[model samples]
Target chain A: MKFTKGRLLEKAKEISTPRARRMSMTINKTDFRKSMKKLVDSEGFKHLSTITGIDVGPKIELIYHLTRENLVLSLKVKTSKKNPVLPSIVNLIPGAVLYEREVHDLLGVTFKGNLDLSPLLLPDGWPSDVYPMRKEWAPQDIRKAMEKP
Target chain B: MATRIPFGPQHPALKEPINFMCEVSDEKVLSVRPRLGYIHRGVEKLAENRTYNQNLYLIERICGICAFAHVTCFSQAVEEILNIEIPSRAKYIRTILAEMERIQNHFLWLGDVGHEMGFNTLFMYSWRDRELVLQLIENISGKRVNYAMNTIGGVRRDITSMIMPSLKEGLNHLEERAKYYTEMCTKDPTVLRRTVGVGMLSPSDALELCAVGPTIRASGIPRDVRADDPYAAYEEIPFKVITYDGRDVASRLMVRLDEVLESISIIRYALDNLPNGDVRVRVPRRVPKGEAVSLVEAPRGEDLHYVRADGTEKPVRVKVRAPTLANIPTLCKMLIGENIADIPVVIAGIDPCIACAERLVFVDTATRKRWMWNKQELRKYATKWYRKK
Candidate 1:
């Protein structure tokens, strides 16, 4: 009942592997959404604290952080930059709206079905085209771009 | 008639720079949209470039009041990644510092909450008593704001026998003062009239919104990071998790006051059982390639830090999630259908760190104006423009 970090990761690996190749179970996008809903409703991982997005080379990896008891289940979902989109978990975890909005604004990832997709952190008129965290966008260059009328 | 009022990035009562676009009809708040990110320093991006040790100081600067909690969470994440066992003595000291911070921070909030409610006597008394805890922290860390006492593995300062007596005396004084403030606030009819039954967040709403700290506790949830996770010396200490079922501003105040008493008890217990050993253990400069999360009970609520390192001096990724961020959505929800006059009091009930919660820009659809202006434009248009000129 006391969930250590090791035990939680082991559970995730057990659920992910066995049925799939490439060492981990890469659930299809539809299956991933269904599994996430099931986890929240049945498993009691109700609190969605944050959704972290990390750009890994060709794909952007999204980690959905959920907590139940002392265990944090990070559901990892990866999508390519060319078509970076994921089903919005806002309806299941209403608290995730701000965090989801943050990921959308900062990383330029599209969260499908997000009602309030307006900028969460960046000001309006901040070049809609520029994402600050990307490698190609330098801080000085962003500032210069913002200044251009 | 319906109208929208703009509460600012520079309001008098708002301690930090944040703007709120509030829609009101018949002097009642219909809804409020918070416009933030005015003070965002790009801390996450900065953390990516700085060494793990350097980020310690940077994280501390995230919020001046919650500096210790931030660095402690950051250090714990690094320690977890490196598989370092902090000395038992170091853990005890860290707990003591954290409790000390909780004590002073609650006192500060007590003062601010009283001020927001127009109770100047309570404000003056609470702040006057708060200096004792601040002085205790200064004695241990040599500074008031950023302690610089926490390292990756453990604490830099040790609690010596000579300072033990002084700490006890300070706690005794604080306990007496806190009792007096609690009595005055709890008994005062005006305070009750203003705070009680105002900005009520039901338990279901709180759970759905994932409100943390005293906010959730006010709604009758018994989740405390210190109690649940048992980080540092918290497992060794004895303390009760405080909760109130009223789910109102009064309930929130009661929870904080009760926790202040508990914090005193924790500090006394930590000092009595203080162990003798090295304050800090040496940790490797480059942590192993791993990701870890550490949660701490900050004065506000649950403070979480997620860290990822790639066996380098710098952390590959660092995400700082303050309790204020978790509580904001709930606070915004409560603002709906409430009288406009009570807006400040309701907002203060959550005890937000404007610096932390205001991490997003608000866009005005009606005006078609972008709220996320660059620093240069801010300098050109905001009050700072006149000052600079």
Candidate 2:
């Protein structure tokens, strides 16, 4: 079934919140999971390509990318660094395993029940407790630390 | 008991540095654990600091080979966010450059695959012919490696009629060479012996694993981002997504070869029907606060980029999901129980870019060790340690 951009927006509006229909949403992690699962089952959104995490001053926003009937649905979840955990979607989409692991590894967010969260792209001896993508670290600091024996 | 052997981080045969640890039992791979993040430069983090215009150059540097695709996708995402429409002629130009990149990339992969199988003659033949495509790219973009042609609103360069004749001749030469190489590789008994039915990925496996590009097509699953989800001038231009039901290294090779032919055809069509208009549209300086995802068929498979902007000079977040990253897990799955000697051929089957694969960083709890390896090094180590007894 082919869907034009307008039809997709309309379908999204019928099922998702107004914010989600506009390709954005702000929901708790638990509600985010439910909304995503609902979209998956009803809309046949089988593909979860990757998860994008952003630190928005006071909160971390998690974007779950989903595609259904030719339209992309990005489900957003906001959480604080104090308790950064989200439900694992590995069970829903097997291909998302590596992507989920990556979100866990880089953003320091835990995906509960994520299998094989082992080191993927990072090296074996990479220092812990330091997230390179965090805005605070300087490039010189990373280079100096990397140059260390 | 199975012994675990570490294959990379530094090794010959791998063009880039990548590390893999494999468990071998009697010369057969029992399981493989890939250690990545050796070369994570924090491109996403870097995107955070750079202005929207400046990030264009940084995104192009994501991978030298797929630089065009990365910039094109990034540009498209930013354009979509700004709700700007590119000129029709610019769209056609972007399509032409993309197909050109595809031709050169597939040729590069062909040569690499031949070298992997110890067929240096084929490698030399493929690379020698690939120069023609590269020359054409240099003629159009003025730079070979990182063609900074794609801009936020449209393309930085235009395809004028002055170069139309040369482009057509180049396409003709490439088509002839593609045919010759495809026949030589597919008909040769040694090539067939090494590739046919080796590292089989069933259709179900390909779909379930969400394999893209030639990897999925080799398994008889026809899913091309260009055709399935049309972007750029692909909607106007017509091209077939080639596939093979064999689901082996040979099948993947054939799929790419046929795709070379299809890309050539598409380029010819786009150039012949090239539209005339302004080269670019002016995009707003600040994008609205929203998120957009753009997918393009990077010479490899599906190249995805997600951009979130909060009406600022820098993006709030940027995530790039290259095709090689998605195919790695599936490649690891195919490596199991295969002869150690065939590892390189299977690994090259995906035509992976290790630089793109190492986009994420991992923290090691035990020794506090952090290092990154590019794609080439990873394969060399896997073959050297695992292929050798």
List, residue by residue over B1-389, the lDDT tens digit for candidate 2: 46554555544434566655667665687887776676777898888778999999999999988899999999988887787789998989999999999999999999888877767788898899889998999889898889999999998888778888998999999999999988987799768877898888988777666777889889997778787768889988878889899999999999999989999999999989998889998777788986678889999998889888899888977889988887877887888888756777887888975321222122233544545544445445444654453
Model 2 TM-score (2 dp): 0.88
Worst 10 residues of 1 chain B by lDDT: B354-363
* Interface RMSD measured for model 2: 2.6
Docking class of 1: acceptable
For model 2, the stretches where C-alpha displacement exceeds 4 angstroms are A1-27, A32-42, A136-149, B11-13, B354-389
Model 1 residue B299 CA deviation (Å) reads: 0.7
What stretches of model 1 exceed 4 Å from their correct place? A2-28, B11-13, B354-389
lDDT (CA) per prediction = 0.79, 0.77
Q: Give the interface-residue alpha carbon RMSD of model 1.
A: 4.8
User: What is the Å distance of residue B128 in model 1 from its true position?
Assistant: 1.0
Per-model TM values vs. the true structure: 0.89, 0.88
